[model samples]
Target: MSTLEPVEITAGSLHLRPWRPGDADAVFAVCQDPEIQRWTTIPSPYHRDDATGFVDGRSPANWATGTAAQFAVVDATSGELLASVGLQDLRDPAGHPGVAPGGDGEVGYWCAATARGRGVVTSAVEVLCRWGFGPLELARIRWIALTGNEASRRVAVKAGFAIDPAPRSLPHPRDGVIANFWTGVLLP
Candidate 1:
């Protein structure tokens, strides 16, 4: 394992930080939004316990294992969490399959209902990708958005992710098939 501990990431209007126990309420509030449950992998009808586990267990557990990095997106001024962002499928950015033992890193993010349409998520994602590409030595950063997810697609494009077709059956966190996917590479 890299033994690189998770740390806070800051963008202009957003900060990506490790989730704290006190974050449960804010997180739960965000999760409760209908749009969140409708679009993202978060369980429909997400209960308080889900938020608890996300804060107290999931994020910290990933750090301990060095397998994932999850950040709570917060307002830069107030330090209030507005959403979550994650870098998953840990591996180098060099596109080397064998030399890099881990899988390709995938960036995932969501914005709070209140924060939607305000450019917060896009700004956060761009900064996060830049940080990941440089220090993490990433070969390619893939952004996958389900078809018709215009918001996600727009963010990827704004962040310099080129749109291209990816295989269907992309194994969405939700139960059904995702007919289309968009993938973009961060060129060296």
Candidate 2:
């Protein structure tokens, strides 16, 4: 597995970067959005500790282990937390043994309530995919949205992904069986 260093990506007015310790409150607040809670896999009844844990442990470990690469999207001018975007399950699917962020990966994201409907997530995801398809050498980046998640679906479409509208999402660790979700694909 190839562990990658974290990076900052600029997509128009959005700044994507590694999660920081001071972002706990913003994380806590954004995770509380109903859309974030319902459509995404973030924990229900989101708590401050969950944000702290994510900022302190989960995010860094994912990058360090090459298991995932998550970015905190913020407004470049205001420095406000705007969304979350990431590539996860980065496996080297070439019959090569250990895990590596190549061959195939999944893109996932959620926008803060205020950032919704502004095309920020779409821009962020596009930039992330470009980076993944380049430096990460990933051949494909996929997007999965729970059924009825039109906002996410629209973002995927805007980001140039083709959706199959099938319940093809694999089981998730936190949400368990994902029997009713749409899947989209972006090939590089």
Top-TM-score candidate index: 2
Candidate 1 collision pairs? 93-138, 93-139, 94-139
Candidate 2 C-alpha lDDT tens digits along 1-188: 66779999876799999999999999998898887898888888899999999999999988988878899999998999999999988878773422354577889999998888888999999999999999888878888887788899889999999899557657865667655778889998
| Candidate 1 wrongly placed segments (more than 4 Å) | 92-103, 176-179
RMSD of 2: 1.9
Number of clashes in every candidate structure? Answer: 3, 0
TM-score of 1: 0.86
Report the lDDT tens digits of candidate 1 across residue range 52-75.
998899878877765567888999
Q: Considering every candidate listed, which one attains the maximal lDDT?
A: 2
